[model samples]
Target: MSLVSAVQVRCPSCNTPFTAQMHRAIDATKEPRLKELLIQGRFNLAQCPQCGVQSALSAPFIYHDASKSLFYCFMPMNMGGSAIQQQQQIGQLTNQFVSSLPPEERKGYMLQPKLYLTMQSLIDDILAADGITKEHIEAIKQRAALLQDIAQSQSVEELERKVKESQDKIDDLFFQTLDDYIAQAQEENDLETAQGLSALRDEISLLTRPEGEIAQQAKQLAAEREEMLDKVINERDQERLRTLISEGRPLMDYSFFLALADRIETAQASGNEIEARRLTKLRDTVLAMIDEQDEAARQSLMQAAEFLRTVIREQNPEQYLRENADRIDDAFFAVLNANIIEAQRRKDENAMKALAAIGTVAASILEEKAPPEVRLLNRVMRTEPEQRRALLQEERALLDDRFVALVDQMISQLPEENADLAGELRQLRDMAIDVRAQG
Candidate 1:
């Protein structure tokens, strides 16, 4: 079963309200296509019909790969809460995920899921599990950053200087990144940026006509790009085409489109007008999809910014938060966290304190909304390590079946790495059982 829900969103651009479907959990084994989206960094993406803007919601979700015995609970670090509160939230999500599984398939690893504080780290580990090395991933990241720097050069001279200085760093990944962005720019009708990137590519190609190992990798990348283009050309299903565009986004660059246009021309010259028309239609559809994704990315960022502005402008941010608590979701926290980090970078103490206050309030609200048992568990966990026993004893009246069951479930699934927490949960469960026996 797909774990998705309809979320109401107000477009930051047009202020038009709409419903967006978001997935709460991903079972990659069942939905391999979704796994592709996650890998392509397009999962949980939403587009506004009103303004045609796409937004990537930074929502909390669980990822399970039964094949690899991988289970991860990703709670955005920006969700702002104490360690105890965060654990309680994670516990709830973990329990829900476990309950969703069939009894036979449910394993001990499912219960003690690995916790990821950030989406990128989670993605990196997922790739690592798939045999992608950290060093390779880091190199790709550096190349991407370098590409951005080259693109942002204020003048031709500056761009040329940067290109020459970073010639050694440029490789297949760098060209792939450049090609991807150029394709995006063309899709969005930013001809200037597209042309600029094309010119930069020409210069880089001349400087490093790669040979041997580098040349072999470049040839492989080109072949993969051609394969992706063929998939788009032959796909008959609209949905599948969309998926292809998303999964092969990196390959859908200037060269891919050029190759596609060449095919269309060849079909037309060969008097295969029907084939030519079909290819043209495919091109149009791809362009539209790219535009929608670009808009979504823009709008999502704008929504986060607008939400932050609203919170910061209010005299009573907490009260505002209380009234509009639904808006303080993962995406909101992501934006807030980024701002807090930027403020810290700038050494703006006041801004950090203000942002931190909002986080504290958000945590408090989350704790307040938790089930009574969960709230009690949070309190117990929050109590001083040495004094928790006394606290639990004093509040023994609260130790009912629900509390005992929760404790037991936690103890059963607790990872060996978390020996301290496992011991604490065991103590709680034992004391709760003893209290019930006495009655």
Candidate 2:
């Protein structure tokens, strides 16, 4: 797709104006993101800030898949033009696109460009490039459509019924749809929607699985350890699980091996050689499942440490931190905090200053996002008389009884020579009274 500039878009839900970045032509061979977005059916999805609503931009775009030896122009029907009418435009775009390719890379198929009037048709064509048959695509689409019905169901009974009837539809597409929404909500900091969708995903999981399978699996493990099954599988915190540690309970992950270790000890202590042998085999089976995850976590921490150092050296620490805030979870902080401790231990002044800048950025973001009234009040209380007057004038919406009273008290206590401050407070008081009266 051509690199289209940002355009102003009004949110349909809230009527709030926002800027949307859109492209009219996409070349997958050049920009991988365009391919990924088209595949996910989110090429032109514009998310609104005022209300968490996603809307698609109606625009013509060309999809160039060099890998598939295909170039198709998707001209939106809403533009009041058929594919034939836009062939010249598409031809020019295709010509420009192919000219940029190397001689060996050019092929004959690229000469005869395909045309699709609808976005959906273009997406289906793209999916076909992967060797997926039409029947498979339709089948997946059928399942994908059921997700809306499932979302609309009012009660758990209705959801459960839909889930039971549409078992065939609960495939990869269904899960992927939920996963994309979850990811979008998290990226946007829409925690309520993210949490709601997460709970729905859990419910869907419970519904789709065979009845009593969860219960049966729970029964397979030890009874006390039974409560810890969800904790381990879901990576949930199980604070009281009995494990290898004598002082405190272990994490769900370490607890599995620790519990197994405990079981081995008990078997030896009780002289149950046969049971101990079986338990060791079971422990080995469990170990196989968790080994990869443990290794990955260790590797991720090392990568995070290196990344933190790189950020300090080569990037704006605040900008990097802000852009990657979501990725900086507990593990990231653990790595960062460890470095801070090392810096302190070694009395490394420059290193400490650099690390401290990271903390300052986080603090500034938190301060900027504080509630409007709280921030206004703090500024009003601390600023000089002239500054306070300007602050009051700027924050007319925050001029309430408490604020007015505070300003009035300040005016009464100010020195006689402070006529400007007192005059400003009186004017503010009048504005507050007017606002309250209207309210």
Q: Which candidate is the best by lDDT?
A: 1
Q: What TM-score, computed on C-alpha atoms, does each candidate reach?
A: 0.39, 0.47
* Residue pairs in clash, model 2: 1-25, 1-26, 1-27, 2-25
Pairs with steric clashes in candidate 1: 53-295, 53-296, 54-295, 54-296, 54-297, 55-296
lDDT of 1: 0.79
How do the residues 164-240 of candidate 2 rate in per-residue lDDT, one tens digit apiece?
A: 89887787778976776665554343445665787788779866777688677445544546455434433323333
The CA-based lDDT of model 2 is what? 0.68
The total number of steric clashes, by the backbone 3 Å criterion, in model 2 comes to 4
Q: Which stretches of candidate 2 lie over 4 Å from their true place?
A: 10-17, 30-32, 51-53, 81-85, 99-109, 171-195, 210-212, 216-439
